[model samples]
Target: MRDQVTSSDRVNYGAVIALVAISFMLLRKWIAGGVCKSRACLDGKTVVITGANTGIGMETAKDMARRGARVVMACRDLTRAENAAEYIRRSTGNGNVVIRHLNLASLYSVQEFVKEFIATEERLDILINNAGKIEFDDLFFDKRPYSPLLSYKQSKLANVLFSRELARRMKGTGVSSYCLHPGVIRTELIRHILVRFPVLKIILSLPCILLMKTPWQGAQTSIYCAVTEGLESKSGCYFSDCAEKDPAPEGKDDEVARRLWEESAGLVGLNPRR
Candidate 1:
């Protein structure tokens, strides 16, 4: 009995399927953005990652632990950070993961965390301020309608400025700073926003699976900035997808950055000094 479909036709179908799969993978990789290929080991180095319990912060912590770095998981939630640190320890076989409480909303909390770190640790290395939300008083908002999008953009600009100033001041001191724009990720933050209007944004959420990066993918640029060598000279440069990018003109204003630094230091009770 001869089959309706010939063997050559079957091979053609298989070839088409294979091509589709490969194309899909390539598209995904492109959408996922650049990956950190630097195999620079972090043995004996210390990495402090804020919000290390969730999203890209967690992924970055796992990478640091895997690379033999001492991972300090700074989080507001102790239980969640403990769970994440335990998981990283088990998975990466690195027991040096520790957790410290850091509530960015409160300056006192940050000071306490720093005091503890300084008292215990001998070396302070990479600091990844991955996630944080400082409570803004009404004055900060100026009684205007709160817009998350606007606030987010403002915060990003602030990050770039802070990094730029930090690099400028820390020049010749062997210290460096970096700021990055992690590609859109399907993290808890995004999920919360979309989950609020699930039915309304069903179409939007569906496309995110292919269009956005996972936490692991989003963390690549952060890991790259932290571990890649020879980036000290590139510090203060804005990065996206693991490569240097030019920030907005406002971000490039040296005087503005310096002023922001001084004002921020005053807010934090740090005396502005060279």
Candidate 2:
């Protein structure tokens, strides 16, 4: 004889499952700190994080601040950045958090952000390129016609190109440029996909949670790149979870990277003095 689930029993079980799911998601949102053995290492150091208003960027900023680094939250929206800074300040009790406006989509904004950063600070210890977008339109899935995925791919490509250019310019300036892929964390960046394609989102998200890392897990790579002792020699390399990542077929195109660098500077109306 086996026990059977009645309608009421099924309803109760469903509610319990929903509750468990919400609890798990909430737990993932509670970001944690990193293990920095020496406080003397990070004192007075400065870090700039693009897309620091949310997701792994926020977690990274918080962890860095907790370790006593002066962290700048560079974002496109000033108000949102301020709010992120406030939350970080409250959460970590570190008042060194500052918000600077930066919009990666626009070369002009990128130049302005860099200019303002250089104007206010002399040396930059770490620059983390962590902003990205994904296209989930139906046409993109159809794969049979024109889609807008090209724009999103271009944006991600620009991030790496920008990092490479920054590394070249900062070669002797004691600044290190690092870029990372923050594995699949659910943030506003992915909210559009979830809203538009709920079924696909659920399928993709399940695998991501099982095979993916949390925002902090993703942030750890940048943390290691920023603070590790031997990263000076690894400046231009891309990282994923603190390990060197092979550039994608496109990312490895030196000609493309060079063109992107020059074009971006031109787009921002900045003359490359070198």
Best by lDDT: 1
- Kindly list the per-residue Cα lDDT of model 2 for residues 94-116, writing each as its tens digit: 99999876657766776567666
Clashing pairs in 2: none
Best by TM-score: 1
Candidate 1's TM-score reads 0.83
TM-score of each: 0.83, 0.68
How far in Å is the alpha carbon of 245 misplaced in model 2? Answer: 2.9
Model 1 deviation from the true structure expressed as Cα RMSD, one decimal place: 4.2
Model 1 per-residue lDDT tens digits across residues 1-274: 2464687788899999999999989989898999999998888777788888999999999999999988889998999898999999999999999998877975446656765654332322332222223234442557778878667766666677777887888777677778888888878876667778878577877777877899999999898888887887786777889898777677787887787777777777776674
